[model samples]
Target: MGLNKITGILPHENTCADLVPMAYFYDVLKNIQKVEEDIINMTYEDGRQPLLVHLDMLLTIARKYPNTAAMCIYELKRKHLKDTFEAWWERNQKKIPKKYRTGIRQNADELFDELFAIKSWAKSE
Candidate 1:
């Protein structure tokens, strides 16, 4: 199949708002699954170091679709993805480059705060 045909099966820009609920459900689940797979495949001596590439991917997603990112975070917490991530962080924190560690932790804390705020607002509505 052509690239266009492949992209056609995915949700379109116009339908994204309507797909928010599904995005919330599936995005977090998929991330969790992918992270688990990465952990299993890791062969590093210090264990699976946190994937800065994954973090960068998330930042790109957040920039392009802020609402979807919020929804995904909401689902992540609801589905216990946060716990999984925390466990991963604990396993890999020490292995992260010292220069990048502080910034990564700050960004992660900010993301958690933003997600929690979004979920709280949603519940109050």
Candidate 2:
């Protein structure tokens, strides 16, 4: 995606329209999931850190749009299923050198599982 397209999707940090409707927010979530999948599937030697970065970005976006039902369900499931993994990821980041973190990054397959589960939960309403 182009930089302009990305900027168009996300709101300004302090905007009054922060809570976009559930449908609109789901669209953004879907795109973020697609980008995350691409990052995970990237096979180059330097792909993992970028993948983690994208995952972090997606988390941040979810937080920003917390009022949306789809985002809410996604976040709740994420907190339940991956909260420990996320904490581990953060702890490891501080404990391990940045160079070594990539080797221990979350796998693409696991990410797909979580993403699909969240998608399913979001659609159940």
Among these predicted structures, which one has the highest TM-score?
Answer: 1
Candidate 2: global Cα-lDDT? Answer: 0.46
Task: Please give, for residues 1-125, the per-residue lDDT of candidate 2 as tens digits.
Answer: 43332235556433444444554556545655554444334432332344444444454454455445344554433443344345435534655566765555545335535444444235533
Q: Cα lDDT for residue 55, model 2?
A: 46
Whole-model lDDT per candidate: 0.54, 0.46
Full-model lDDT, candidate 1 = 0.54
Error of 2 at 117 (Å): 11
For candidate 1, what is the TM-score? Answer: 0.47
Worst 10 residues of 1 by lDDT: 1-10
Candidate 2: the clashing residue pairs are none
List model 1 lDDT by residue over 3-114, tens digit each.
Answer: 3332354454443444664454465457655765565455333634344345445545555556655555543443244555566677778887888888878877766554
Query: Mind sharing the TM-score for model 2?
Result: 0.34
